[model samples]
Target: MVPTIEMTTTWERTCELDDLEPGWGEVALLGARQVALVRVGGEEVYAVDHHDPHTGAPVMARGIVGSRGDRPTIASPLHKQVYDLGTGACFTDASLALRTYRTRVVGGMIEVELDA
Candidate 1:
């Protein structure tokens, strides 16, 4: 017999889908952590850490939202370091990485799945 582990996901409601403006970022408080919510188009949404890893500043919510080819990206407001919105991978630097959280929309509300 093989042993299996079950994984559970807890999605916390952050805000309404209409609350986020396209091509802009919004800050959402997930408990004590600050999360940056970016809405690319009408339905596509992404959630990432609001902290800027390079500057140690919680200002990612004010970062510029754009795209690198097909991948959506956010550039830090302080240093202009670009990061992939979907994977939190730094495009300008390889050593630094921004944390990302899973997000979904339910009943016209945005929800985020925090890491446990």
Candidate 2:
């Protein structure tokens, strides 16, 4: 699928706030896109690609969530590559990165703004 390059887009409800847990992740389907949703603490929610770019495996939802310095991160289960949950920057490598979605909570539901 072609990715849209527009400046901004509408927010889509991905899941309920109760569906996630801290230090863990879940998969959410956004049309053809597969996203990994994770709840850190309080009402903070983060979204990234479910597929790991390094291993080409759809196991990012099972990745371990933690912090690398000041950035929250998810380490890939396959190769132990740490990726920043906020910016999707791979801490293990400067060349690799994950796609992060903008997330927010509204009325006890989680919403993500997909790039368009």
Candidate 3:
């Protein structure tokens, strides 16, 4: 007998534009992965791991949304570790970095590309 193969896609639509407000963060559960989505400047959308790499806590969705220069960032509520929303690099720690996902707005909905 032949074994069946399974294929998984990277990009997935998690929520609509209206589901999340500008300058705020929201949690999107992509299967077993928890993603934190944020709408910056009322236009650009960014997605990162819901778990804060420093604290290992799943509270990034409740973290503060702000920017450093032109790059958007989220400060971990637990330890106040600032992370770049674009590259998921920790500003203060510099040794650790969060995981960032590719996000895009399509038809007023947000789509995140999960890494395999």
Give Cα-based local distance difference scores for all models. Answer: 0.94, 0.92, 0.90
Q: Kindly report the root-mean-square deviation of model 2 from the true structure over all alpha carbons.
A: 4.1
Summarize candidate 3's per-residue lDDT along 13-89 as a digit string, tens digits: 99998888888999999989999999885658999999989878999999999989988899998989999999999
Clashing pairs in 2: none
Candidate no. 1 TM-score? 0.92
Write down the RMSD of all candidates, one decimal each.
Answer: 1.9, 4.1, 3.9
Candidate 3: list runs displaced more than 4 Å. Answer: 1-9
Which model scores highest in TM-score? 1
C-alpha RMSD between model 1 and the true structure: 1.9
What's the CA error at residue 108 for candidate 1, in Å? 0.5
Output the worst ten-in-a-row residue range by lDDT, candidate 1.
3-12
Answer with 2 or 3, whichever has the higher lDDT.
2
Reference-based TM-score, model 3: 0.89
lDDT of 2 by residue, 1-116 (tens): 99986696878899889888888999999888899999998899999999998978999999999997878999999999999999999999998999999999999999999866
Deviation of model 1 at 26, angstroms: 0.6
Say which candidate scores most in lDDT. 1
Clashes of each: 0, 0, 0
TM-score of each: 0.92, 0.90, 0.89
